[model samples]
Target: MYKSQRELKKDAVRAFLKDCKEGRFDGAYVFSGEEDYLKEHYFGLFKKYFLGPGDDQFALTVFDDMSFVLEDFLDELDNVSFAMSNRILLLKDVDTRKLKGEPRKQLLDALAAVPQGTAVVFYYDSAYLAGDDAARRARQSEITALGKSARLLEFSRQDARELVGWIRRHFEAEGKRIDDQTANYLILVTDADMVALNNEIEKLALYVEGPDVSREDIDEVASRSTGVNIFEITDCILSRNYDRTLRLLTACRLNREEPTVILYHIGVMFSELLYVALAAARGITSVDTVAADFGVKANRKFILRRYFNAVSTLNVDFLKQCIGLISEADRNLKKSRLNKWTELEMLIARMISAQIRK
Candidate 1:
């Protein structure tokens, strides 16, 4: 596990420079991250650093599917110029957010048994790659283990604050600045989609010649974005502030977000708290004990700790009732008897009242 975006960027730069300097057949490189620029940046390197003028590098290709086989790319790589020592093959979107299936497997195999004198890169949106599916999780570990020879660059997903910081860095990188008001506006508009936010910043920087970009600039240039923050929903429930709760709810419906998405978010969080509640009821005495016994996701521990504090005074009977609420909500969402959003709203409201963790 490579964990930092900067680390990945540095490794990529180092790999490209090394390939150019040593003339070694660097078999393959894996750029895994949520940042889209990694794709354009490295692919540009393949063009500028390696492919000289008048070089028709048929050996270069971009693959969105991870299942892309090394054999399938052999035709392109086989025609490699005797003059140029290595070829560039890009297997993009390997984790299958943009593409999937046989191509993903093929790409993995290419990384496993990469041909000499060729530079291949297998890319994935690491945010999606680390999602909770067991099989997907195993596939990532398998690929990392098998591609022992390939240099690995892993890009971790940016959270809300980090994404905003990235936006600030982008402006600074271009020798421009965003005004405080404009910065907040951009953050609000992009809603922490780093890729989209970066794109907007580029356009705004180009449109305005001054060092400072104003809030008005963001309104005029940045794309309208949606989707309630996962934290907002959780925080609202924890605080039990009616207006804030309804505000998030209204944001959800106003954005035309799918009820299933909201349910997925809230349900997952509640399911976690339910586990905490259940653990405490089971005579589990401490946070460390609950964490070690259940073996939950790392981030979930904070949420678990909150649950314990909230429901400390509640007895086992109330905890059982809360567990039943989550199950009922899940069942209702799965069925068609009532509107999904309404059912979720009601479930959340009820849970707040239940004082599972007041």
Candidate 2:
């Protein structure tokens, strides 16, 4: 049967939960994904089923695959649990993609013969995986081999709709409410990292006495991630808010953000703005249509209005010049001996000056 990727993920989670409920802990399991929240949640659930209080040190064994020897891990698996029916072996940050030759064969053999009375979990945070195609193929092969004797699961990022629902439920659990619009706005102003989102939600719940969470509440309480800060900085540049732009640039420096990174983001923002502006000039004014054209997310579609307004004040030639300036700054930051902060400051000053002169 050919199931869609979404369907496969859903089935994997469902099967894992069923096994946990039935107390049918497998001999070996593999968790490979980018979503840390679900990964940690399932890890806790497995622990609850396999161990009791104070049993971790006795019955649980943890190893970092990078440093731990394969023979040592296999030896531990062969050993019996201390004062428990089963031992839990957790292998963290195991990127099978990097395994080769002897180590790879040893790991495959161990997976084939995971010792009795041992619950082994091979966990990897996909976020840390290398972006190269070779690494990706290696990971896929590893997952396939492990799947022969282990329950393989993957946790992917949720879409905007699911995120909004999660936010609403979380707020409700804390005796508060957040409307859909406000929830989407929250996502727009933050990274899609669930751990950070959960922390922000909890902070908002504690800070706001009212039942409803507003955009104002988010702005005041939620810590802006670097991505969010870059977006704000770009917004400031587009609006020609000189003081605000400089303030944000200072904030970036204070936080020790690299000048190259800031310049890269600014270039991206300007490029995207140019695309939206060009589309609008061609009479595509609908936000949904324009966003779809640019492959922008629903939550971020709100930025189109700002982009449109900013683009109205500037021409295509000037936007291209701004992009060129950012590129030049990036090169100077990397190749030249100039101070990073000074180069970034000059870039921003020139960008603002260009906007004014236009």
Model 1 earns a TM-score of 0.62
Q: Which stretches of candidate 1 lie over 4 Å from their true place?
A: 1-25, 52-59, 64-71, 81-86, 93-117, 126-132, 158-166, 173-192, 203-228, 238-247, 254-256, 267-328, 355-358
**Residue pairs in candidate 2 whose N, alpha carbon or C atoms collide under 3 angstroms:** none
lDDT of 1 at 270: 56
Scored by lDDT, the top model is 2
lDDT of 2 by residue, 133-233 (tens): 68677776777677776788888766677888998999999999999989977877776668888999989999999899999999999888777888888
Worst 10 residues of 2 by lDDT: 77-86
Error of 2 at 351 (Å): 3.6
lDDT of 1 by residue, 140-174 (tens): 77557545647766544343445556667889999
- Please list the residue runs of candidate 2 whose C-alpha ends up more than 4 Å from where it truly belongs after superposition: 1-7, 23-26, 50-54, 80-84, 130-151, 271-322, 353-358
